[model samples]
Target: VNILTTLILVWYSPDAKADAPQWTFLLCALGLFAYQSLDAIDGKQARRTNSSTPLGELFDHGCDSISTVFVAISACIAVQLGYNPSWMFFQCFCATTLFYCAHWQTYVSGTLRFGKVDVTEAQFTIIFIHVISGIFGPSIWSTKITSLDVLPLRFATVAMTIVCGSVSLFSIFSVVFTGGVGKNGSTVAGTSVLSPVIPLSFVIIPACIICLKSVQNVYENHPVLYIMAFGLATAKVANRLVVAHMTKNEMEYFDSVLVGPVMLFLNQYFNFYIDEYYVLCLCTLWVIFDLMRYSAIVCMEICDYLSIDLFHIPLVDHPITQLNKNGTTINSSVVNTGSRQTRSRRHHH
Candidate 1:
C-alpha cells in the first residue's frame, strides 16, 4: 500500500503545472491519508490474526524504511522544495537515520521506545502540512512568517538539521548513559564503553564523511546527486540494522558497509551532471540485497514456526539477552555465579 502511494507520488512529482495545481496535491494528500491510516492498524491486525512472526516484523520495518524516504520525497514536492538538492538530502538522511536509531534503542535497552517527536508523530504532522500546502499552494512556505527565515526550504533545512542532530545526539547519549555510570559513580569500561560508541560511530562516521564531502563540493547546490549518494549510504546502514535485528547479533557495520557504488558519489563540485544509470545501479543492488535478506528471514521464520530446527543464522536473535532480562545481563554477580556453578558442576561430576 505504501509502495503504491510512493509510485503515485512519483507519478505526480513532475506536474509542471503552475503552482502544482490543487488537484495534484489532493492526490498526494489522499495517498498519504490512506497509507498512514492503514499502516497504523497493520500491526494490530497482524497480532489479532496471530500472524506476528519474525517475517511480519521484518516486512513491517522494511516497508517503513522505504515509505519513509518516499514520504519525505513527496513532502519536498509539496513544499516546493523539489527543485533543491540540499533539502532532498536532508529529508532522506534524517528520516532513515532516525528510524534506525529507534531500532538501535530497542536492541540495546530491550525497550520499545517511541520518542516524543518520533516517526509516527512526524508523519501525522506532515500529512496536515501537505493538506495546508495543497490548499494554500507553495507560497505559504515562503511567505515571511518570522525574522529567522521566511522561506520554507531555508527554515526546513535548518530546523531539520537541528532536529536530526538532536535526536542522534540523544540516542548516542542514551547508549553511554546505559552503562557509563555505575551505582558507585565509577565509569563503565571495556565492552561497556565500546557498545555505546559503536552505534554512535555508525551515524557519526557516515555523517562526518558525507558532510566533509558536501562542504568540499557544495553538495547543497546539487540536491539530486547529493540525496542519491546519501540515500544509498543510509540504506546500507539501515540494511545492516535489519540484518542485525534478524540475526540477533551485534555486528560493527559503520562505514565498512560502503561498497563501490557509494564511493563514486563522493567527490567534486565543478562537475554537475547526474548519471541516471549510476543511481539506478546503486538502487538495483540495494533491492537485491533487500530481497535476499528478506527471503532468508521469511524462510527462517516459517521453519521456526513449524518447529523444524535446521540451519541456524545468527542474525535474528536478540543481542541483549546476554544480559539478564532485568537489565543486569552484564553484572559481575551474574558472571561470578556462572563461574562458581561451572566449578561446582565439575566437582559433583
Candidate 2:
C-alpha cells in the first residue's frame, strides 16, 4: 500500500510530466484519497477481527508519515513547476510534520483520542477539502441564490495554511520548553525541573515573535496566507490542549503553568523578540522533535508486536486490555476460551 501510494504520487507529481493535462491533477487528488482510505482499512480490519498487533499499528503510522512526506514532496515539485506558490509547499510540509509529531506524542502517551474534533478528524477534513477543491478549482455552488460561485480555492488554501502554520508553531513552542528542561531534547517531556517562567519564556517568546512576523508579512502583502497560518497554529495548539487536559495526568499541572504564563507574556511583549535566529531555532527544533516522534512511534509499535522489552519504550507498561460485563480481568487464557466459544456459537447459529 505504501509503495503504491508513493508510486502514484511520484507519477502524478508536477515534475513527472510538465504541462500535464488538467485531468491528471484530478487523478492525483483521487489517488491520494484512495491511498489514505486503504491505509485506514488495514487498521480497521485488524481491530474488527481482534487481530490488531503492535507491528500493524507501527506499520500504519509509519506508512502514513511516509505518505505525507511524499505528498509534501509532490507539492513542492508542483509548486516549483509553477503549479502553486513555493511557500504553500513549505507550509504543507511543515504542517504535515507538526501534525504527525503532535499525534505521535499523544498516541505514545496514551492521551490521543478520536472524536468530532481531534487531529485525525481534522486531517480527514483537511484532506477532504483538498480533494474537493483540487478537483473543482475551489468554486462554490449555490442554486437557490443567483449564479453565485464560491471560490473554494481561496478558502481551501487558507484552511491548509492555517492548519499547518498553527501546528508548526505549537511544535516549536513544545520543543523549546522540552529542550530547555533537557527532556529527550524533543517535545515528549518525561520530566522537567526548570522554573515555569524560564521554560515558558523559552517556548513562548520565540513563538510570539514568529507569529507576529507571520502576521505582519500577511498584513503587508498576503492577508489570506497569514489568516491560514494563524488558523493552523491555533488549531494545533487547541488540539494539544484538549488532548493534554483529557489525559488527566499529573503533567497537566506543569503544562497549565507553562501555557498560561507564555500566552500572557506573548500578549505583553509581542514586538520585542523578532529575529531570524528565533525562527531558525524554532523550526530546527520542530524538525528534530518531529523526526524523533516518528521514529519512536515506529519503534514502539514493533516492540509491542514482538513483545520485545526496550528500556527506552514509553507507555509500554500500559498494554491495552479488554473488560467483561463484570469488569473483571480478561487475560490471554480467557481471550482464547472466548474465541473458541464465539466460533462454536457462530457455527450453531
Candidate 3:
C-alpha cells in the first residue's frame, strides 16, 4: 500500500508541486496512516497466529528499513520539498541515517532502545504534514509565518528535522560507544565495536559522491528515482547488518547492492557515454531486483533451517526440534511456553 501510494506521487506529481492533483496529497496521508497502523500491529498478529520467530522479527525490520525510504519520499512530495533538491536530499538521507544508526547501535549494545520521541511520533508528524498539504495545497509550506515574517514553513520543518536528528544521533552514539556487550568491550558479534562503521561509510560515501557528480543533472531531474534507488541500496546494507546481529556474524564491507550506485558513479567519471537518466533508470531497476532477490533467498534459507513457514502458522501446533551445541535434540516447546508466560505477564500489567 505504501509503495503504491509513492508510485502515485511519482506519476502525478513527479516534481511534487507542479501539475499535482489536489487529491493525491490526501491519498498519501491516508495511505501512510494505514501503513503505520499495519506496521505497528504486525508483531501482534504474528504472535496471535502463533507464527512469531526470529525470522518474523528480521522480516519486519527488513520491510521497515525499506519503508523508511518510501515514507520519507512521500512526506517530501507532500510538502513540495522537491523545489530545493538539496534540502530534499538532506531530509531523505537524514531519515535513512537515523534508522541505520538505530540498528548499528543495536549491533553494539545487544538491545534496541527507543527515545522518548521516536518513530511513532515521527510518523504522526509526517501524517499531519500530509494532512496540511492536502487541505491547503503544497504552497502553504512556502508561505512565511505570520509571526516570524522571515521563516518559510518548509525551512522551519527542515530546521526541526535537523534538530531532532541531531539529538537522536547524539543518543545513539552515546549508547554505541559505551554499551558494547562482548569481550573487552567489543560488539555482540565479538568484533571491534567500531567495525560496523566501515560498512555504513561504504553505503553513504558512494551515495554522496554519485549525487554530487551527476554531470547530466540526473539527480536534479529525477530526485524520486535517485532517492528510491539509493534507499534500496541502504536498505540492503541495513538488512545485512540486522542479519549479522541476529546470527552473531561479521558484516561484509562490500555488498552486491553497491553495484547500482557504482554504475552511475563510473558512468559520470567516464563522462556519461550513456545518458545519466537512462543509467539511473537501469540502476534503480537493478537495485530493486537485487534487494528483492537477496531478501527472498535469505528468508527461504532461514525458514528451511528453522523448519517454519514464511507467512503461515501450521494448523497443528507442534514443537520445532533442533540440535543444540551438544548435538542433543531440543524441543522449542519450552521456549514457546516462556514466551506465552511473558505475554501473559504483560497482559496482566
Provide the lDDT at 136 for model 2. 52
Better of 1 and 3 by lDDT: 3
Error of 2 at 218 (Å): 26
RMSD (Å) of each candidate, 1 decimal: 14.1, 13.4, 8.7
lDDT of 1 by residue, 1-349 (tens): 5446544545655421125555556666777778878788878765544445566566667667666766766666666565445555566666666766666555554444665666666777677767877788765766544655535443564476567568765965576356533333222222233343364455446544544554334344334334444454455556556655556565464444354234434422334245434543454466446545655665676677766433322222122223444544441211222112111111110
User: How big is the positional error of residue 112 in model 3, measured in Å on the Cα after superposition?
Assistant: 0.8
Model 2 ranges off by over 4 Å = 1-17, 74-86, 107-109, 114-159, 163-349
lDDT of each: 0.53, 0.41, 0.84
TM-score of each: 0.64, 0.41, 0.88
Per-candidate total of colliding backbone pairs:
12, 8, 0
Candidate 3 residue runs with Cα over 4 Å from true position: 147-150, 317-349
lDDT tens digits by residue: candidate 2, 100-178: 4445445234344343344445446545544553565322211123333543233344455577567555654454343
lDDT of 3 by residue, 1-349 (tens): 7788878877977765564666877787898889889888888877666777889889889988998999899888887888889999999999998998999999999998999988988888988988888888888898888888886788877888999999999999998889589888888899987888887788788878888877777878888888898988888899999999999888888998888888888898888889998888899999999999999999999999999877755554344567666676665532243124211111110
For candidate 3, what's the RMSD?
A: 8.7
Q: Where's the lowest-lDDT run of ten residues in candidate 1?
A: 340-349
